[model samples]
Target chain A: MSEKNHRVSRRQFLTYTLTGVGGFMAAGMLAPMVRMALDPALEAAGDSEFVSVGLSEDEVSEEPQRVDFSIELDDGWYSSEQSRSAWVLREGNEILALSPICTHLGCTVNWGTNEENPEEFFCPCHFGRFERDGTNIPGTPPTRPLDVYEVEVRDGMIYLGQINQRG
Target chain B: MRWNENDAKTYQSAKEYVDTAIIPLLPVAGGKEQEEAVRMGEFTSYLTDFLERQYTGRVYLLPPFTYLKEESTEDRLERLKTWTEHFKNQGFSHFLYVTSDSRWRQADARDLGELVWIPAFSLAEMDTNKRQQSIEQQAQQIIPLMTEKWS
Candidate 1:
């Protein structure tokens, strides 16, 4: 049964060793590129995770309040938590969550910052102003209205997702 | 806009829209103290970066102007005025000079720009929450000041 079966041939030994080492080297070279390609897909899976801004349904009122929250962002190999803020208000039966970022630039807009326009949102950067309904005032720097968030109310808690561009 | 190729291109194309220029003045010294100063400067730069991002289209954030702490104030002011003049010629109407060094406060720079001197906050000693809180507080104070200038 025997000596020939128990001992490996030179050709077989060389083929097995070379293939094993070659496969390992190939994987080592391709692993990072594969990860780079798949990273966006992996990150997209977590994109739907809604962050709570710690505001309850009862707390929301007609007056806009600044609500701050943090979100986990994955940029290729780097992962970091970024802080975000939104001006949230309750209008009758609906909730309105508007991004404070000005449409003209990226500056944060304040509610009633301008004493003359107490009902509007005002941008400090360039005097950009928006109406009480988050509409950009005509003749202002901002051409578009403030971005609104997708809101979900669960168990009296408010959850915010991706920002949706509004008119 | 930052002093990078992409932002520079934007600045060039939209010079009319981009009217504000932010210059961060960082002071460096010799020896171990230089390391601490540099670290503080880095934190200051970070704050400027945040400010620039907040008002991206209208504000152009230039890279830090690093100078020796021992350098003459008259000479520095002369050079800074020239720099601001260059920026003004390029269509920038508003100039903001942000620094942690109190020395800049003593310098005559009315022709150069508005000097915003913030007390240096110790980033190394604070936790993330405290650091964020400090940054937010500083930002809150700065926003109104910048807005007043615009008005």
Candidate 2:
């Protein structure tokens, strides 16, 4: 309405707009850091999903047998890892799924035939011997059993879920 | 409400209904990697289960025909013939073959008293949004024929 009143109102509007623009610019600069902080929380919400092992029940051996399988796991967009393990034995109708990871130290275990010892799974890292049931023997360096997967069979196929580490 | 809004009460009711009324109607088969396959195959099987459970008067649940990898056509034929003979002996009203493999040709469609060849839909063909629609369509087509033949 009045010239002085109009001038004062225009100055107030400009001040508010500049402050809002500055605030937006600051947020834009810090957005990456904010995302990085919240990344773990987002991952936890969707982490460790169940994956198909692609084995037919008929294919699994009745005795303590080694079945090697690999599954692709995604950590994020940047990387993918191939997780390979040997599932041991189908006890009756249920499966005893074991991870061939050395418990003494984290090392990949191999199934090899020792002429003296017959065929057994051996961890070369510390010379750990795991039985068909994945139990570490008394004299071996490994003090714990191999990891076990929660398994379920439905529609003539197997699915493996989270792994439980032995104490 | 929002487009993706989930009503807890409605969701719970639907889940309870599926668990109690629909799941028992399904023939649960077990195999290696079956749990995973079932998880993937649930969408298709749900339609079959729903129809068998809810429309028992008109629809019959058929036993699944197991597919084996064979080397010779003779072996395949023998297997198929044995399946048909088994069904007939089991007193099944009609027999149907569902397979995703297009290479399987029904040489003897009329061997059994009533046999229908239904192609199994691939996982890629039915996207997530269209899964239920595809199942419903398949059920409508397959169920009608079985009813017409056996009922």
Model 2, residue A74: what's the lDDT? Answer: 62
Best by DockQ: 1
Overall lDDT per candidate, in order of appearance: 0.84, 0.54
lDDT of 1 by residue, A1-167 (tens): 98878899899999999999999999999999999999999878576778888889899999888898888877899998787889998777889999999898677788997888998899877789997769999998899999999899999999999998976
Q: Comparing only chain A of model 2 with the true chain A, what is the TM-score?
A: 0.66
Instruction: Candidate 2: list runs displaced more than 4 Å.
Output: A1-8, A45-47, A58-62, A73-83, A91-94, A105-127, A150-154, A161-164, B1-151
Question: What tens digits encode model 2's per-residue C-alpha lDDT throughout A1-167?
Answer: 77776565778899999999999999998998999999998877454566667786777874555554545566668554443455657766678888866675444565553444455656643467887677886797778888998777778787777778876
> Distance from true position, residue B27, model 2, in Å?
61
